[model samples]
Target: MLTYNLSNIGSDSLYEHLYKCIKKDIVLRKIKPGERLPSKRTFAKNLGISVITVENAYSLLMSEGFIYSLPKKGFYVADLNDVQPTKQVHQETVVLTSGHTHYLADFSSNQTESEIFPFTTWIKTMKEVLKDNQKELMINSPCGGILELRKNIATFLKEFRDMDVKPEQIIIGAGTEYLYSLIIQLLGNDIKYGLENPGYPKTAQIYKSMNVHFEYVNMDSYGIDPQELERKDIDVIHISPSHQFPTGIVMPISRRYELLGWANKVKNHYIIEDDYDSELRLGGKPLPTLQSIDVSDKVIYMNTFTKTLSSTIRMSYMVLPESLANEYYKRLSFYSCTVSNFEQYTLSKFIENGHFERHINRLRNYYQKKQEIILNAFQSSVLKNKVEIYNESAGVHFLMKIKSKKEEKEIINNAYSKGIKLNPLSKYYSNSIENNNIYVMNYSSLNSNKIEEIVEKLKQCI
Candidate 1:
């Protein structure tokens, strides 16, 4: 008979507790291989629980190859020829979904504040889209996403970014990570690729995972050094030109032209312009995209709603040159669009009705004020004399050069121990080029009400 103290299940459900207890016994061979499990009713009576709970536990065990069932013969433990004991892992990792401890001042996260989302307006737009697009919602989106959404995006780009692109030239996917995979397949893996050193880590991680041949090209003060690309004989170069990550250096017009000229010289040379947070630029008009200036069809432009909209949106898109767009359809049209029809229709209506634009305007104002509050807090902090802020105008994050003699790793660890998560600039680099004593401070998600406490925590970290 199977029995467990049901009263001590704690937070777990009865079935779940029984499942774990039985699984543990089976792995330990206390419930031997080929041993018959008690009938659901009998086990339920033994443990003083419902028959459904016992049945649920048995079902889970059978599903996991821990046991087997016959029509009338009942459940029996499977032969345990190769099951191994579980290795020790962090308790929090097993129990908590986020896997990291909450921090008082999390300068490592770039997540947008949840309060900034216009849920009322968004839900209203979704309802409107549902009411109007019933027939369209039933149909699957095309490989390049729905025509309506693409059209709205194209119009938005022209009006805001000054880039004239046709709907056919855009490709929508679940996220930038998915789009990067498509880019790799569209552009042959045989070519050499260049990524900016000390750039976004995920970009490098994606290229490496896909078995792509890529090199880290060092950046000068302006942005990616075109002269280095020439020296490296790179084929495809990925850069965040409008506002570079961590450093927040916006590419000068001269450097943008130089990169375009470099791409023009070679037959298949191309540049990938990742204009991630251009919409949230705090000062002046956003910079014109490199694609808008490229006459030779050498730039593939990419952006994501994860910055402007909520991170949970999982929507991103790219603008391909006309030639590449044709090539993409020819080579990869069989794959269906990754986003759902409902989301596409809703977002299309949201953009077409000006809700998205209004939301972005509101968000820009909110973030600008948040930035001001945090900067003011830092200015008044005890560590104000020990830190220098840089590139505070553009993205949600910027660099803070700390005047400390401690090694970067030691400083970061000290901060983490004090509930302040800090990410050093040196950690982003792949090569030996050192960027010491600087940390990237992402403040978009910081709680403005806790600014004083957060500043005190930062003071302690320093």
Candidate 2:
């Protein structure tokens, strides 16, 4: 008999819960193949659920090939020989999943200070848009994006990033992941992609899930080794040259030019420039974007407003080359923009009214102070002798090389035992880089007062 205690399945829809329970039994062969299922009326009466609920659950299962029904008879379980049960992964990783323990001072987030957001200004802008632009909000943005938001982004880019970007060249999406998928689709899967080792793992994970061919390109102090790029058959290279993630190595002009020269070597070569946090460069003069320097139309520039604005805002934009822009329209013109019109218009107003610049400035100052407090505490801590500040050039994170007599696993274990949840530099790498003592610390969301507590714990552990 189908057993479902609906009262205990809190937070799930009744029909959904029924569907899932039945599906699980079918998959596990508890309800064997070809076994008859109770009719909707009978099942509803037995379970004390509405007949429509039972019908909905059966319909879902039948639609999904989990069950089949005869015209005059009840439903029968479909053959689920192809349905394999998922296995648990026992491999050890420094990933911050639900499996990882909690912490007092979590330093593994790139989330901006939510307290610093201009909520009043944003609410006011949103209201203004809703009042006058209700029709615009109801409709979808164009294939690329709304003209107003794209134009403002272009202007912002030219002013802040020194990129000679046109509005039509910009493609707005929900976030970097969506934009990345679009990029893969636009560029075609035939090309070999090169991702930076010891870089953002999410990019690699996305590529893998899409079943695309990609390799890890090793990096140096300058950036991805130009020689390594030249030797590989990689047709596309995704990088954050302005300020490389995890490493924080800002590529110099020589390296930038060298990269451009390398991209020009092969016909149809492209460089995906992930300038994620360029505006948050807390130190040194802001360098021109890689796309700004590329005359060959090789660089694809991407950025988002999450770090400067709010994490909840999922708007991320990309600038395609002129030729590729036309190509994208020809192939993907039917695809609507991922960002909603309300958000697009609101963000446009935010940028157009100079509030965006102010927000970035305020966040830069705020994070600079936060970074200083954390860094100062680390320097003045008892564990300072064992830890060396590696890179503090850009973004809210800096690398620290821990010099300890203990093994890497033991050191990490000790830190975890002390309730210091964190990750080793090895966590980000995909085989090209060797991880020894380096670790990444993102203090953007860490409270100022918790620094001493974390440092004291680390001192005791390290």
Candidate 3:
């Protein structure tokens, strides 16, 4: 008889207690590989627990790879060292099912609402580009990008952003992620990268995955603190000064100059300015890029068409310093990061014809209207006293700071159950133990009706 003490189990649920006992034995290697477990009925009877409890524990053990079952035989301790663990392919299936169900509102992504997309105009432009640039599409262009697109980008920057960039300085790639990845590889290793705390998680995840040393610089209402940055010995700083993600706080000109001064003081250091959504600034005059302020060739500016145009475009470009541009071309000579020639040629013509400007103006006006609706709805809500909105004047999303953190999950769950999805503030933090009561709600995807409904539902939840 295997002498096992049952009196020590303290869990309220018999199955949970039994599961832990077997899992502990398996982990400690006391239950040798391929050792058969007691039959479910026998084990349950011996322990004075229901048979279903033992079966449930065994099923869980098998699912988690702690044990295995043989045909018409019994469950045994698994040889974990040699076990081919099952991939979690089913995890996404459940999420997909839940996502497809028609919801009253969804404020998750920073994308323009489905109804706002200029589908007809885009299709017309795409067809024209394909027809006129068919010959260019047949062959591969330079890795840096087609000359026409580069020239158009330069002109666009000059007219709109007051950026004095040339075609030679522009390098086109699929998206911002790809462009940033190239920078990481080109810059080599052993350099410290700095990111904004409570900023875009993707930026942090990519750097960490590359095994790069990085620090999170704390952010304030004015954006990332330059004084705090002086304390850390960082080689590069990545910032989204135009419209900071999640918070939507724009960096003031004084701080921008200060940051530039910091980079100038440190020799060979770089700053990556991610102008992800600057084109959508509704009220004030659009700010000049950090690259434009670079007197010392310290800032590398990158922007994407993903936000302004459409996500499917897969087009983004960077304006590199003359020194860096030369090095990049020489290093990436064999590797091609150029987009499709047809698409580039089409986009060039689109901008040259002034459609791009008109498109941006239309979107600016549209977003302004949506922003107004959101502001009005929130102001009149019952939860107005309990929650205060931040970053409402700009960007696609706004942050709602609650009075307490206790109801954070409750509110999220209630909203989710009502077909409204929200991202909790804690989700954005690397350190979750910190007390944060903010919730990020994107208005870009919500229509006026959806926005009103969402606000009313949120009021009830609070």
- TM-score of every model versus the real structure: 0.80, 0.78, 0.78
Cα error of candidate 1 at position 383, Å: 1.8
- Candidate 2 or 3, higher lDDT? 2
Give the local distance difference test score of model 2: 0.83
**Stretch of 10 with least lDDT, candidate 2:** 92-101
Q: lDDT by residue for model 2 over 231-320, one digit each (tens)?
A: 887889999988888888888888888889988887779999998888999888878887999999999999988877867789999999
User: lDDT for each of the candidates?
Assistant: 0.86, 0.83, 0.78
Across 1-462, the per-residue lDDT of candidate 3 in tens digits comes to 232454444523445567788888988998899899998878866765446567767877877778988888988888878967677475411112333424466666665555766777767888988888788778788888988889999999988888998898898998888888888877765888899887789988888888888998888778877777778887898999998887778898988998898889977688999998888888788677888878999899999988888766789999988888888888875778558777788788888888888888888898888888888777777766778887766667778887755556656554654556667767766666454667787767676867777778777666
Model 2 TM-score?
0.78
Highest TM-score: give the candidate number: 1
lDDT of 3 at 139: 72
What's the alpha carbon RMSD for model 3?
A: 9.1
**Weakest 10 consecutive residues, lDDT, candidate 3?**
92-101
Position 410, candidate 1: lDDT: 53
Give the range where candidate 1 is weakest over 10 consecutive residues by summed lDDT.
Answer: 92-101
Task: Sort every candidate by lDDT, greatest first.
Answer: 1, 2, 3
